[model samples]
Target: MNDETAYKVLTGTEFAALEAGRFEGAPVDLADGYIHLSTAAQLTGTVDRHFSGQNGLVVVTVDLAALGEAVRWEISRGGQKFPHLYGRLRMAAVTAHAPLARAADGSVELP
Candidate 1:
């Protein structure tokens, strides 16, 4: 969870799977009933906690405006507010994306 609204991060394979008109969601997302997105500050923790050791990852900056009502800010880990998409993520909702590469400090840079 984070204080600011930042971009989302996903693996390349996950992004490819999102190519379908409706992104059903990742395994965790499906189990949780929504798409999980991480903000800039939370990105590193997210990667280390969930996506570490994974390659070909991408940082996606999605259009929250496009998501409209589908996006909801809710309290998750550590009681911080996080954006959750209750519905399928449409491909058109994404605005930008880039490789998830770590810096010398081991933190990843956003697209």
Candidate 2:
């Protein structure tokens, strides 16, 4: 698992809603009080458990360095540590983004 960086998977529509250099985050994030992030090793499980059978999903790579104190490592599902951001996600902090596409067996590749 990567310790230096994290990823945020969002729908294409949610990604398009990002504006003014910030992302409002998903509804789950709002309810939880932080933007949930996934590690490279956890990406597949996150999709399988929460986003199964979905399409047009976008995976965003976030620079942990940019989040500073706003980011927290929290224990979540399966007792794994997940990155959580307390504030709006800054678009400038994203390094790259790509569509989440599945291969055979319905598994997706992280973009």
Candidate 3:
């Protein structure tokens, strides 16, 4: 993935809805109130290839801190506990202006 598409930001409620229906049975991680979602298929494909096959899935992490109070409320409704929204969200690839990089500490660092 390129810089413009490397990161995708979604509201908690939106992610919750997507997770409840579409991403059922996918692996999820919640840490520091943030939700990280990944699917086995996505992890094994292009996204995984871009990430050096690290997780074998396309992972999307939603930061709770980035959500508004109303969004959180909506996401938690109906006794539906929220899980990390992870999956292979497919999109058209675009040409990148510059290359992406990783820091010495192994964190992705963009130019």
Candidate 4:
């Protein structure tokens, strides 16, 4: 949950793509020209707003330091600074990954 790490929520298919070695991101990311990432605080909202009622989702922990200049913190979603990756995501940059889990209040559980 520290600033050193960011989270990428991916569908099962997208995760499979990443496991293959690299990930270009999802449709929205492709359209936006960057991979969308959320902080621990923003994660639940991102999941609730985008992946509600869906299953088989996974949360990938990204090492922001590894991304270096590829990560840009931009104002987004209620004026908060969100991390966006401007290049392809390689498996080497992923610190950890696990299936998405929700709390009793339906909030996303950080991996």
lDDT of candidate model 3 versus the reference: 0.31
Q: Tens digit of lDDT per residue, candidate 1, span 7-85?
A: 6666677778777564588889989999887777777887888876788877887777777788888889888777888
List runs of model 3 lying over 4 Å from the truth: 1-21, 29-53, 59-101, 109-111
RMSD for each of the candidates:
2.3, 1.7, 12.7, 1.2
Higher TM-score: candidate 2 or 4? 4
lDDT scores for all predictions?
0.77, 0.84, 0.31, 0.91
User: Would you estimate the TM-scores of all the predictions?
Assistant: 0.85, 0.89, 0.21, 0.95
In terms of lDDT, the best-performing candidate is 4
Model 2 lDDT, residue 49, Cα: 91
lDDT (tens digit, per residue) of candidate 3 on 17-89: 4545542222322333433322222222323333463432223433332332312221332343333323233
What residue pairs are clashing in model 1? Answer: none
**Ranking 1 against 3 by lDDT, winner:** 1
lDDT of 2 by residue, 17-61 (tens): 763454688988988888999988888889889888888989888
Candidate 1 is scored at a TM of 0.85
What is the overall TM-score of model 2 with all chains considered together? 0.89
Order candidates by lDDT, high to low: 4, 2, 1, 3
Selected candidate, larger lDDT, 2 vs 4: 4
lDDT of 3 at 59: 31
Clashing pairs in 4: none
